[model samples]
Target: MDKITRIIAYAKTKLQEDLTGHGFDHAQRVATLAHQIAKKEKAQVDEITLLASAYLHDTIDDKVVPDVAEALAQLQMFLAEIEISAKQQAEIIFIITHMSFSKELEEKVTLSTAGKIVQDADRLEALGAMGILRTAYFGGSHQHPLYDPAIKPVVFTDKTEYRKGSTVINHFYEKLFLLPKKMNTKTAYEEALRRQKFMETFLTEFYQEWEPEKANFF
Candidate 1:
């Protein structure tokens, strides 16, 4: 019945059909992470805006929705219809639109503390065991190879370059491994580093499996 409840319902409906790991469950996890990060860091943030943005962040994402412009318009209309105030709507829209990694590739947009919290939460989701599975799932869905030593990881500086896609293993180097330094909050940063280390361990085993002869010799 409340505005945040309606926003969650809208996000769930929009993201439920996604198969690329950006589903409603992923959004819910991000919301939970945002809440935890804010509390751990003792940062004063607008909870309503943070939670709403976390839930809806991917609803209008180009990766999730076919027509991003249309989705954005529909989401704005829904917010207004649900009686959310203008200032809150603006904050929510700004956070969701600018918090994405692809968007950051284009330009480093300044965000509010709440936006930073949500951004950190989402980035954290892309770093650990969950991140590895999500990367593999997305690559499988997009027809990207699991690993191709022939095709090396790229240093992408733009959305076009980033979205062109790369091998699943290469994604760890290209994006996921670099997230720890980009974290905004100390809590998120520490956790990101821990997750990054776990991913490194995972990759070590993957390489050992991929090159069994090398492992056998050792």
Candidate 2:
């Protein structure tokens, strides 16, 4: 198989059974979004590198693998076998490693045009209707509470604090609501605004349903 086809097959195999929202479907969606954004931006980005990074972004994530170092080593070997250029491999790895929201929250990292497009696409997945479903799926898989009035959202200063979230509803305030402003590309930024508005509507309806008695007050 060609390298791109092989990478897609590998990603599908790796994420086929994932229940925490980082499944193959999510990867595919991100890859598609990245490609669309790249074309729309008409920037001097490497489409192959961006798409490859999108497909493999979560493969070696600590959230998915018990040993990130080992997973990444294996990924490097796979890239070498596929005969991807060293520079392209580096670009893909750089985008995957730095694209995560938690990583971005922790430190500022500059990205190439390709990296920026991929990052925007990945972050876009964390908004809108799909974002809500993914959040619910992840929360359910992890046994996190759906909602709790007393468990207010906390401003996370680090990845640890972010992951220690007690309720899924708090995620809106903590991250989802903030993603629109963080988008890297103009096209994605506009799309994010629309999705962000949808999330707001969903949250409003959710609160009303959660407490019909307090709906008038809201």
Candidate 3:
């Protein structure tokens, strides 16, 4: 099989045990989204690096892997065994390690075109209908509440604080709603805005159901 296929298989194996939204399926969707965004933007990018980063993004994530150092070592060894050049491997690692929202919450790193596309794709996954479900899924996996009016969402200036977790509904304001403006490409921004609207509507209905007496329709 080609190196990209092997990389994808590696990611699948690593993410198979994930109960959070950052599973193999989510990685695959990110890859697809990255491809679509790349095409729409007509940006010159290293397609292999973009696809590999998209598929392998979560494999070494602290949220997924028990030991991130070990995971990174193993990933590097695997890339070498698969004959991916050191340069390509470096590019792939850079994209995955720096693309996440939590990482950006710490500091924004300038990205290559491929990295930007992959980043936009992953962020897009966190914005729409799927984004809503994934947020709730992750919250449930981590035992975070669905909502708590008494506990408001706070602005997270760093990854550590962001990972401390928040209510499912609060995640929309904390991260998801902010994605559209953060998108790297015009195509991703437009799509993200559309998805953001959907999530907002869902939240509106959710609030109504949560407090029927206060619902305007009542």
> For each candidate, what is the lDDT?
0.93, 0.89, 0.91
Off by over 4 Å in 1: none
- Of the pair 1 and 2, which is ahead by lDDT? 1
- Taking every candidate in turn, the Cα RMSD to the unseen true structure, in Å, is 1.2, 1.8, 1.2
The sequence of per-residue lDDT tens digits that candidate 1 reaches over residues 75-185 is 999989998889999999999999988898887989999999999999999989999999999999889999988999989998987997989999999999988999999
Candidate 1, residue 39: how far the Cα is off, in Å: 1.0
Higher TM-score: candidate 1 or 3?
1
Least lDDT summed over 10 consecutive residues: which range in candidate 3?
A: 209-218
In order of appearance, the predictions have TM-scores of 0.97, 0.96, 0.97
Could you give candidate 3's per-residue lDDT for residues 158-213 as a string of tens digits?
78889988898899998888889999899999999899888879988998999987
Candidate 3 local lDDT, residue 74: 95
Candidate 2, position 154, lDDT: 83
Residue range 16-128, candidate 2, lDDT tens digits: 88889999999999999999998898877776787799999999987777799998998999998999999999989988988788897788799888888888998899999
- Report the number of the highest-TM-score candidate: 1
Name the lDDT of candidate 1: 0.93
